[model samples]
Target: MQKRQSKHKGKSALAEKLCPVCQRAFSWRKKWQRDWQNVIYCSKRCAKNKITKEPKPCE
Candidate 1:
């Protein structure tokens, strides 16, 4: 016997993740932050190299 398949296969929109720094929406990914839970930055660079490091007082 032959098998049948549906027209729509493996077609789905990616989940949007918010960035902690910029606070913007971004595309979802796998392997790297696949969990998509408790995400910090939108990009690797942003996450790796954070703007604020030391505790500095505001002028």
Candidate 2:
């Protein structure tokens, strides 16, 4: 018997985006399929610790 082809492609073929909070490259995920455009953080931790204000310069 032949193996069935999956609807989804390989990981390398998936799209990628940089996480604003961690500045790391993240690939598309099944959970974010519908809302991939709105994803900004790599993980929940980064989302919670997102930068809210610019860092103050040392005097």
Give me the runs in candidate 2 sitting further than 4 Å from their true place.
1-8, 53-59
The C-alpha RMSD in Å for every predicted model, in order, reads 4.7, 3.6
Q: Which stretches of candidate 1 lie over 4 Å from their true place?
A: 1-12, 32-34, 51-55
* Tens digits of per-residue lDDT for model 1, 1-59: 88787664342566676776777888766655656776668888778766686889899
lDDT of 1: 0.70
The residue pairs found clashing in candidate 2 are none
- Listed in order, each prediction's TM-score against the native is 0.45, 0.70
lDDT of 2 by residue, 1-59 (tens): 99999987789998899988889999999899999999989899999999878888899
6 Cα displacement, candidate 1 (Å): 6.4
